[model samples]
Target: MSRELNNTLYQSKSEHNDQELAEHQETNKRLQRLGQEVLKLEAKAVNSLAERIGDNFSRACRHILSCTGRVIVTGMGKSGHIGSKIAATLASTGTPAFFVHPGEASHGDLGMITGADVVLALSNSGETHELNAILPRLRRLGVPLISLTGNPDSTLAREATVHIDIQVEKEACPLGLAPTSSTTASLAMGDALAIALLDARGFTAEDFARSHPGGRLGRRLLLHIEDVMQTGDKVPQVTPGTLLREALLEISHKGLGMTAVVDSTQQVLGIFTDGDLRRALDQGIDVHTTEIATVMTQAPQTAPPHLLAAEAAERMERHRINALLITAEDGRLIGALNMHDLLQAGVV
Candidate 1:
């Protein structure tokens, strides 16, 4: 190509690249500002919803507490989705509750509701036909009814034993057609109700963990060092004078990649890990004749049996180490654990 033509092409490409970069930056800034505005609106809506809380909320809580059966949450459309989540949260937080789709309730699901149960219904307009249809049956069964709706005078709210208003001043949707602020308000109110009930019922972390046994919450709250740590003969241990070769045998036998070097009182003086072995080998140290204490790390990291396995994992991560010795209050080693153990126990 000619030099002049090549120079012109390069200039055009540079200008195009600059324009594209400018447009990208402007688009990102616009999106960020719009996101912030939406968050502010939602925050304001939640705050307004909180201000509207009154005696009706208290009455609803009392009714729920007094019920001898599960709290049946029923709703339609978007409200139904939110109601299901609320029911799940309530159930996990010590209040027994479950969602019953209002539409399904007419088709034999109504039998799921008993006289001892309390009904918590949701409808943004407070005039959902499906919900209103079941009101008569709920009333006939003598079940207490609590309604969450945007309209105070709607049929569902009027029929409710206690009505908690969830009206929002404006919808976050620019078109004002979609359920936005109203749904957010309802969800926040449901969370408030579930948490209040949880507090009233004295729901503890252990109770919460029991309901979430397969997740990180269960690991952090329910798993202790004693539950996952290697105890007794499984703990690789050697006295101060023990040769590094024998300690290596213990490490291999236990499959923990390390051995604890202890004194006469069984108090851990140092730890010799695979990493230390490599370093010693690099330094031309004789493993067969060397005493483990001579090459061991003094005052190694130790955790108590009562410590959470999650915390132990954190400790190992923070130190960039893979194993920890379980020690008593006076620093005597009682147990041991490794990264693999945490992984196997589902605590990592």
Candidate 2:
């Protein structure tokens, strides 16, 4: 929308004029119709997927599930890029797989293949030059083959042990030269394959986190405070009877902006933060002679050493605090972590 029209519609600060109101209503109607058209198209595409799940697709799944070695995916053009991502999804979801570009397979990359591996060939037309060149070698090696193509009777399909058809009547593109609907179909089919294997393997979040340790989901599900917390002598701790001034030295030395007041056995008694210092001065309490027991805040927020770093980060942010004392189940301070630790661990 143009800025002038947008401001007239939204920034008017009152109901629009009669003529402007009619124009706005007409524009909204037009946008609604466009949304309806897109929904209809997407519904047709998704339904095509459900309808295409037949015995052939089942057979292909069975073949892949029974395979002892990796699934070697290959394709030409748009199918190739989709094939690469599909292969990656399969690998991450517990199905061993990798994509080999058909063009590269003919240019000395064929050595990566073995007789034990299954070749998953993808092409809209089922006829690609580079793929044809490798078919002879694949046949010689006596490897099982799977074809994903629009044409069911092409040479590649004819030689395959299992053929999965991805036929579509038209391209989503207006020009018809660009691959759009066909690519969408191919990518959806790839997702179907990955999801099928993902369910079959009973893959859990932990399994996925093991594969993607750098991702946000991995950090949320796999990272624990014990893995990143400051433990032992580095944790700032002071006895409850310690003078307030002495606790300040511990906080400054530890640089966590807080000090834990504990008993002789190290069980938590209370905590004092930099904020507590400001309040003490306001109340005219002498830091030098006053015991931390008299001024320390009881029931300070603490986290278990086993809690996820992300969960701890959320708790701290919600409470508007920077640091948390990691305690054992018995309330003994085991470790400490602050906002900076989470940032360094890439879990923030």
Candidate 3:
């Protein structure tokens, strides 16, 4: 009887493991199928924009470009979240833009919009009550309205100076209640407008970098050699006639892994790095007595102070080097930097 009881317990545990495995597989299958459906619907919505981006998109870009003041973006609900992101993108991409809540705009926030500013309103359903409530006020202020909506005949659409129809075939939601494809379409439309204006204004990466000074791209684009390079006493430098042993001491003192071989006028003539020391040792050169000019690499690559830190990184990468000397246009060594400096500056 005891043996039978143990056998029963063993069978129960085995069955439970099998059941858990089957449940996990089923859950994974359901998640994958749902993900695929959502992606397909969203892609279809965005692709549909190809056909709709005609004269109206051009007009929106042209009007926004011609506006002397900032672009004021406003929306309600989920549209507001997307509107905020769109406004940020526009602002970063050379179009000055900011988002205001439609509900707030109905209050004293209406004062934020002026005649010089262009209003870009987002509403999947063009008749959002909060947005419609402020249309007359916007009109009174003489602000041009650009509407992004699914219902072109709705109040907001009809009231807009330029109506952009962002209608999607259907939402990815199984119940057709929550916004999915419509919001994706609106966000993509906003990106399209921002990029159009970016190209129209000839916005360069330098301009974008200036606006994003705290970001990694900004560090790379805006940081110059003069900003991070070591100068004055921090530079490990030696005259051409300096002994190799003494130059090694300078390299050790500066901790830059290298030293510049310069002339009397502080003009860089060559460079000696840790690697050069290794080769000198292998070739049986006497470090105590050898002149650095005899062993150092002549006519070493140099950079100007104004060269971007990212460009300096590229130079280091291309040459398989780890250090660079910052020079003036006339070949005077002004500063020095290494791979560690670029890393510390977040340029690499």
Could you say which candidate leads in lDDT? 3
Model 3: per-residue Cα lDDT at residue 169: 96
- Top TM-score: which candidate number? 3
Alpha carbon deviation, residue 53, candidate 2 (Å): 1.1
| Cα deviation of 217, candidate 3, in Å | 1.4
Give the alpha-carbon lDDT of every model. 0.93, 0.88, 0.94
In model 1, the clashing pairs are none
Q: Over the stretch 149-197, how does candidate 3's per-residue lDDT look in tens digits? A: 9999999999999999999999999899999999999999999999989
User: Which stretches in model 1 have alpha-carbon errors above 4 Å?
Assistant: 1-37, 231-234, 239-241, 261-270, 274-285, 293-306, 314-321, 327-334
Of 1 and 3, which scores higher on TM-score?
3
lDDT of 1 at 98: 100
Sort by lDDT, top down from the best: 3, 1, 2
Which segments of candidate 3 are over 4 A away from where they belong? none
Q: Rank the candidates by TM-score, best first.
A: 3, 2, 1
Q: List the residue pairs that clash in candidate 3.
A: none
**Where does candidate 1 have its weakest 10-residue lDDT segment?**
34-43
Cα RMSD for candidate 2?
Answer: 7.0
